[model samples]
Target chain A: MNKSILTKREKEVFELIIENYTTTEIALKLKISEKTVRNHISNVMQKLGVKGRASAVVELLKLGELSI
Target chain B: MIKRRFIKKVLVTSAVLFAFLLMCLIPNNNVLEPTQQLEYVSSEVNKIPIYLLDSHNMLGRTNVAINSKEIDKQARELLEILIKEKGDNKLPSGFKAIIPSETVINSLTYKDGLIKVDFSSSLLDVSTENETKVIEAIVYTLTGIEGVNKIIIYVDGNILTKLPKSKINLPSTLDRSYGINRDYSITSYHDITSFNVYYLSKYNDVEYYVPVTKYVNDSRDKVEIIVEELKQGSYDNNLMSYLNYQTELEKVDYDKNEIALTFNEYIFSDADNREVLDEVISAISLSIADSYNVEEVVFNYKNEEIHKSVIKMLE
Candidate 1:
């Protein structure tokens, strides 16, 4: 709802991460490579300066960049 | 009259001697000043980046004096410096040319940011182990020249699309993306990401950087990958990383083509002095310049700015 820090693709990837979509399942659902799925997560994590995907999701929610 | 004539002669002789001495002193003063001599020398020679194989058989970059100013001529001159047979005398101590000694450049043409170099059959004389290194040395050295972004290597007028010994396929146009000192650690062929990371290597106690192009299945951003690998240190015994394993990167922030890294206090070599080792700085800046497009990197410890480095300055 606030200024979005995550890119469109990154938002989609995180939205799926919040839904508990596995990396492989997210890749299949998005019709992208599993590596690409991981890359998206990694990119967002890097922007947020967090170490893991869960932390990234938590930070995004705190920043109001994502909604569950 | 005799006395007067003698006096005149003496005066004339003295006057001539004085003039002769003045002329000699004037010439010495007219000799080129040291500053002027240095300017003349720098004008006639350029310090160009030349990537050469070091004692450990890794490509280490060193600047070599070149006399050419024209782009085409400079490219040929650098290529000559990269050839083992021709460039031996030009190389710095402990460095060797990666190109095979017998290789000969048939022709070279440069236009529109691309250089096409045709080499004779002898170019393939390199051993299988050094085949990729030879290519890397060429690509990195040539691209070091200003305005040269791409290169096309040809053997006898045919595009060299594959390495004869290693059988590694090469694109028709080669650039930094081709990577130097390639190390593959990927689990699967699919979804491979390649990034360049600089590691420190020593020759005769002198430290230099060797860039390794790592191909891994990890899909992390390049900065993250570089930091992680540098922290892991070099797998090769010859290469080393100065980054402390305990150092942790806390946050990455970007603004206006610059990236800032915030790290723990462990990043400093001497916490009391707030000092980061030069080798550590070079390793990080060089790796970041090669992998990331940012023009500057700012190093921070505990949210305080410690050092700022320009990417071009590192290169």
Candidate 2:
């Protein structure tokens, strides 16, 4: 996965979204606002030219930003 | 004949107003019939409260009702609502999401009463000042789920031990034990005891109850602490008012499934209207239910059972 395309946080959020954690659970786990989590996902999506959480995750895995 | 008609009209209007006011005072939906109460008891969905920042930037809780009985599912739904720019719950507009936008959850697991949730790293982007509030919102929201007693947070599958900006050390496992909305002003030499309590807040002139975990260094019972907090009024001015200053806790008793509180006449006499009275009942019930094992909170005035709230008994 070409991990350079996404910020560290964005990659982390993308990986988690792919893992199936909900926004609230992510916020609780990371000790940050759910808004920030979404922001990271949106940022990744914007960067990858993708739409939706699952698509971003799939693109990241393909780009080597994430893995199986 | 015209004067008689006018007098009759005035009487009818006043009677209607009286009934409306009475309806306002009584526990409207709370007094549910057995079948309707059963719906809540056997509900497939859970009503979980997610704490968010209000217009004043103080911690305010909004309950999100979801159709999933699974705790993990409920937590996810709550996260979705909490992260949204605007909450999907019935809470009024002034209440805003505390979690920064774009954050997402990776997974949530429960084992032996401990809930472990993994999230994306974007969760680290919250401002330092909101660090504690963010934790409070998360802890309060997760712990609100029954059987889920503690929380362990992770980022990208890695356990988070400290906050990024604030560097606040996190407990390996966090529960209500960590405390929410710390009452730092309380000065005592002894160790502090922390627990969750519900308080009142208003949005659009409608009163909503918010749960907060508070710390006290005193030896008072948890029930007394709840009453005392209510009497102090909400520290946040934007929140609603409750509990007359003179509303003292006359007596308190509790068993495994019930707690009874006797308050001074101020509780009844000081309630300016039914709405305020309902607020009082809710504040008391919701707060006391958090820390105590009791299922019913009985309110008494002058040694008589004035009203009883089954807050804990509710599903």
Candidate 3:
């Protein structure tokens, strides 16, 4: 089915993260509220079973889920 | 008319006899004789993980066959296999024992998760380049056995506190914390964090995992560091990572004794088939199992759980 772990918005939020983007920058770049960006990160973390944003980024990279 | 009929009958009889003889002369390819058939006999041979140096001189984990069930016997047997001269024939292709040839195991004693083994002075005869790797192979391989968590080495009855050639300091007691195939990238000794991460390497066509203990100055989460280091791939040409450079970690959520990872579709070798490569899975799972105290790892794509790796199974 070509299923993906993150939605378009969620992936966008993480792509910015790899570029060393902060919550505000990601929110601004994606045109989403800061709260929404945080939520997206939180949702991805919850799905990944990891506790932190950095860990999530690391896991995603290992899984080939996100690109630098 | 009677003579003619008799002659035809004789010819028919002779033809039937010749056909029977030809059939008997031809070998029956389908039926195997009892002696020629293979006998199926089950043995107690077990495949146990043994750490050894590969062709690239990297400490790699591979399995060796042993039939012993007793822990003491198994420990000694594994040690024998780690000695190059003794166990070269026991190893699979592409692996070489790390223990120096002709080094004798003076004595081995195990109790309460600790193993104390004394080796002959010849153990120190390893080249400067392989000094640390020799110790690493011993520590990792011995500790890999269940119920044996630590080891102490003695050369000719004195604790091996230092390497003669490399001059690297050694602790009196050793465990996995001693680290195998280490990579030191720390700027300073202060605030140093050490964690184990696994990378992929191949010998011939067979793929195996190599654990690297990395010392870095960053005090961030160990898992975070592991993923980042893994993403950078391995600096050593012998080692590699299957992680796509573009892959990003979307989120990490931890439950009791388990860590789950959310990733983009790049994690899958076949995204359409929703398949993750075994090499990829082993590289991540082995690294996590070594660094994190988690018993299980759940891999997710979006919200759907794609794969689950039990930590014990990877070992």
Candidate 4:
């Protein structure tokens, strides 16, 4: 049940993360504030329902949206 | 794939995609690039030696090279591919893969539960992070692939002479050595992928994950590797190690014409702090001038009783 819905902005964050981008860099790259970047990551994590950064990565990978 | 897949349809629409699809439907053994060159493709034929491939002409669509050069050519191609994959001639585009551009992959093999990867000494670099990153990148890359569990790295195809952090109990195999470093920049290390292996770095005697945050600003640069358990009753061994460590790290910052001499608490252990202080002075005596040519070496385990011999050498 793919209840997890990611906004286009959240999708951008997810893509950058799998490629090893830090929140600070993601903020700089997207021209957003660090707080907003962190918020998006937090919101994405809440939607995906994962606990840790690594866990969110694993779950997103499980959904096949990101590939190593 | 996302961008390329879409771009291929619109921009390349002028390139006869319908004709290409028809050709593909015809079951011909080739896919034309945008240049429209009919480059033949064959998976089975690629495995055959080139000499045999050259010897025959499409006699009922049979490949022709039938001689010794085929094997040699194929082997050469394999080497070229591996070299390119190494990306040392350039670099792994985004991440900090600390191994040098010229470093050669001497041998890469996998068997049983281990992947034994050997590289040239060029792989050796300065900074604790570089050593850790190269180790992590190589190990994870191999282990991430199917059928690999452990990795042992070799320099110039030989095991390291001295580990970055000298271990009390000798490692059981070549894989245990994390070769010596000579430089100080932390960017020498590469970005680690998944799987956290908390390898302890013996900074003095206390075994712990040497956090490199003091050296790098990249939040993802947190690297750790597993060090084996101490055989001599873990607690005591840890104490003695940290004690020895404390003394070893004490240094004189000659840069500011200043010195930071920390007395190892353990130097007060078997011998009085005085004797340890004498050794510290003697070691620092080797050199501690503010010329900027010589880097300052810290002493974390010396005695307070400084010897004239040490001061004289600094002159």
Interface RMSD of each: 17.6, 20.6, 15.4, 15.5
Taking the tens digit of each residue's C-alpha lDDT, what string does model 3 give over B143-261? 77777888999999998877658454566788887677766664432345678889888878888888888866676777777878878998788888988776667889899999999
The positional error of residue B221 in candidate 2, measured at the CA in angstroms, is: 2.0
lDDT of each candidate versus the true structure? 0.82, 0.69, 0.81, 0.40
What is the TM-score of each candidate's chain B when compared with the real chain B? Answer: 0.80, 0.75, 0.80, 0.28
TM-scores of all predicted structures: 0.68, 0.63, 0.68, 0.25
Candidate 2 lDDT over residue span B51-112, tens digit each: 77776576766665677777787777776666756344434477777677767888988778
Query: Sorted by lDDT, highest first, which candidate order results?
Result: 1, 3, 2, 4
**Which candidate number maximizes lDDT?**
1
Q: What is the TM-score of chain A in candidate 2?
A: 0.85
Off by over 4 Å in 1: A1-68, B1-44, B188-191
Instruction: For candidate 4, give the lDDT.
Output: 0.40
Candidate 1 lDDT over A26-50, as tens digits, reads: 8999999999998998888898898
Question: In model 1, how large is the Cα lDDT of residue B72?
Answer: 91
Evaluated against the true structure, the overall lDDT of model 2 is 0.69
Candidate 4 local lDDT, B78-192, one digit each (tens): 2222232352232212212334556676776656767666677666643443444344334333432334456666677666433333211212232312221111223311232
Q: Where is model 2 chain B poorest over a 10-residue stretch in terms of lDDT?
A: B183-192
